[model samples]
Target: MTDQISDAQFTARTLSEALPYIQRYAGKTIVVKYGGHAMVDERLSAIFARDVVLLKTLGINVVIVHGGGPQIGKLLDRLGIVSEFKGGLRVTDEATMEVVEMVLSGPINKSIVRAINQAGGKAVGLSGSDGNLIQAEKAQKTERDPDSHIEQVLDLGFVGEPSAVDTSVLDALLKSNSQLIPVVAPVGVGKDGHRYNVNADTSAGALAAALGASRLFLLTDVAGVLDKNKNLMREIAVDAIPDLIADGTAAGGMIPKLETAAQSVKHGVGAAVILDGRAPHALLMELFTEHGAGTLIS
Candidate 1:
């Protein structure tokens, strides 16, 4: 089967298939939350950089918001910091926040920016702290007691959600460089001069909503979403999410991704997609192909 079609035929077919998508999103903004294995694997990371360059060259506004949970954990372990989690939110104390800021805003952010630049795209690295791009409030959680079954507020220190996203900086960057891609680190600043560690997915969703982006991509380890039977569900509606979560089909970290996607859609972004970043050129396939790369929630 592979020998049947020549390279020229494949190229032509791919371009023809992508024409409509390119037209639909030629000047639209796309926010991608890049993480998981895709961020760690060198080969996949290079491919991602090329794909981002391709998207920017095609006239799309590409904003990359990334997660460094695994990286952060590794650093914490190296520093002998015993980390804790409450309701899936990291217990980011002042010390942990320091490491988080350095890791997210320093190495991780610049690396992605450099990758895109090397791939022929103008790229900038930013943290929410820069220009107060993302103003956040301390995040709180509630958990039910197993014995008393009473809800109690749990303090998840230094963890925050976006209260406001100021896109002026992003606008300035975009205006100055038509093909610029911004790689954002999910670190926010509070009004009180405190730095907060935000969930990458939530941060990306907030940015997308604020920008009215055409799509928000949550690039994960899994292939889009799977049913309880482990079959891929190509598309989901915002209203259908609660039921899916209640029934346990949407489990673990995926629950938060879906929540972010639904919120992004409701807040004005066209759609939010959960796609497998482990797949080569997954982001490209999601944007430019007839058969998309993931499960879309709109």
Candidate 2:
């Protein structure tokens, strides 16, 4: 019938469209910063796992960095702990640090690892503390009084930034024929023997720089960067980010994402993308199709 014929034609076109992308990305390393809506939706979660497995099967190395903000918030609420944020950074005191570790490392990281395994890929769950992978220092807090002063030092109990990253451990994992996919949680320790919660995006950016990855993909809830007309802008130069931020088009969390993308490009990574994670097979569509779905910040 006519309906059956339409379905067949669509299937053929879809497969043809995907062929070039599979060929292009095969054998290259892709670092996927996996979070946002895709992680919360069960069907989307399975699809994401399948996409990673397929990439591995085709010989593309995948490194996954995940965020657990929602999960941490949920747990904090359950425990009757109130969270405070300064400049969008969670002010992590001692008690909050405990919950951060428990949620990020225990349930969330392991769940992703399990999904990848169930989807038939080899996955390893790692924290920044593992193999001394991420060495961090206590992030210096800023005091905003009448005069913004760095002299007023407030301790954001366990918020740390990556001062150093050793890629040797990651290299060894990738070299094995097992096609190991690393699922990393951003929790690092400082020289002063304190645990700190690093922003997952920052951690992933640093990892991409350290590993010199071919692509760094940040999966979020939006459909890439929009122009004044609200149309998705496919390609954007790194220098334009400042204007976008200043013009109020790129505000809120997108600012940090743009900052990370700029840092990645500056440090020798090929490209960084901010793609909508809600779209099914969004990863494959972005990587393989000529018209990608998210903002490609080069």
**Which residue ranges in model 2 land beyond 4 Å of their true spot?**
1-13, 141-143, 146-154
Please report, as a residue range, the 10-residue window in candidate 2 with the lowest summed lDDT: 143-152
Off by over 4 Å in 1: 1-5
* lDDT of every predicted structure (CA atoms): 0.92, 0.89
| The best candidate in terms of lDDT | 1
For model 1, what is the alpha-carbon lDDT of residue 68? 95
lDDT of 2 by residue, 1-298 (tens): 9999999999999888888778887777888899999998999999999999988998889999999999999999999999888755789999999999999999999999999999999899999888777789988877665565445566677899999887777888888475899999998877766778999998999999888888999999999888888989898999999999999888888899999999998998889999999999998888878888799999
The top-ranked prediction according to TM-score is: 1
Q: How well does candidate 2 score on lDDT at residue 188?
A: 83
56: Cα error in model 1, Å: 0.3
